[model samples]
Target: MQVWLDSLLALLSLPQYGLTTLFVVAFVSATLLPMGSEPALFGLLKLNPEMFWPAVLVATAGNTLGGALSWWMGYGAHKMADKYAHSSHHLRALAWLERMGPKACLLSWLPLVGDPLCAVAGWLRLSFWPCVLYMAIGKFGRYVVMTVALLYIWPDS
Candidate 1:
């Protein structure tokens, strides 16, 4: 069992696949999809201990770009809101988004609602630079803290 686990871990640890997987996972996770990027970071770190910072940065970039994409989608979907007005959830979502403003983008690192939050920000035509800044901050902080915490608890990680 130990050997099998180690082998599996070793495979996931490789720099190429691990890093690519991190970007892919982080990107998808930042899109309204119920996904996570932490496991990818942990997996890569476990394999290539020296790649800690690189992995974090890569994940952040990928996630940030994904958030940007969601923002564009929202910007484009503005006209479609009326088409889906029958859905109470969509109405509430738009209303809540209107109430929060761009600052709500600070929580863009969160799951489920985070991606959609970014889209709404764009749809509302909030200040672009500020939203992007907040998104990057939130996303980067998340990766940094999670990675550091995981490594601290498990040095071998």
Candidate 2:
């Protein structure tokens, strides 16, 4: 099992598969899951410096899509909550989200709260298109800044 996993990792590290693997990692990382796509992206960039923009674009797209999926999940969860549970705290959070609107999605690039912020935006029934636009911008900035900073800090890495 370990050997198979190692082989798969090795295959994914290859230039032909690196961008796809980075996309998957970025997508998953943008969800509620506790994962980081930076290392995968950094590794790919270190291996193929020429693919910087492609990798950044791919990561941003995957991460934005993942955030949209989180938004959908939050929409469904909000519907369920509306049907059943309605605590003061929940109402307060919903109110906050409503007040903030899609502009709040600018924080979707944060480490822990980022993905959940996308969900909360949906939970508040905020405008979907605006939220997506903000998410894309924030996520794109994050990918570009983070990848470039990492490369600058450790060029050989």
Candidate 3:
């Protein structure tokens, strides 16, 4: 198992499969998963400084797509969620979501609540394209800001 893990790590190292690995990491991280993709992005940038823009764009795209997937998942589970909709917390959240509409998706870049926010948008039946657009914009900004900040903090890396 150790040997296999080592081989997998070698295969996914930044030198040979940087962008693909970053995309996968970013996508999975944007889901309900507890992982973070910043380390992967920073590692790739540290290894290949020339790939800054490409890495950020790829990461943004992957994360946005993952959010869209979460939206669909929530859409499919609408009935299940409805069963618990009578709670006060659920009512308040649902009211806020309805009031904010697709604009709330701009916060999709936030930690902890971001991914689930996308799902809730779908559950509320918000406009799909608009939500995706907001998500993309927010995610793109996050990637650019985070990557630049990481680079600035570790310039020598």
- Which candidate gets the maximum lDDT versus the true structure? 3
Candidate 1, pairs of clashing residues: none
Residue 79 Cα positional deviation in candidate 1, in Å, after optimal superposition: 1.6
lDDT of each: 0.85, 0.87, 0.89
Q: Which segments of model 3 are wrong by more than 4 Å?
A: 1-10, 154-157
Q: Write model 3 residue lDDT over 5-54, tens digit each, in one string.
A: 87886677655598899999999988889988888888888778898899
Query: Which 10-residue window of candidate 1 scores lowest in summed lDDT?
Result: 8-17
Per-residue alpha-carbon lDDT of candidate 2 for residues 3-119, written as tens digits (9 for 90 to 100): 999888788878789988999999999889999888898888887889999999999998999999898888878766665346887777667777888988988999998999898
Off by over 4 Å in 1: 1-12, 83-100, 154-157
User: Candidate 3, clashing residue pairs?
Assistant: none
Error of 2 at 64 (Å): 0.2
Which digits, one per residue and each the tens of the lDDT, describe model 1 over residues 1-157? 9999988767766786778878998898888778898988886886687998899999999999889888988888878766887798878877876787777898998867788889889888887778888899999999999888888876665
What overall lDDT, based on C-alpha atoms, would model 1 receive against the true structure?
Answer: 0.85
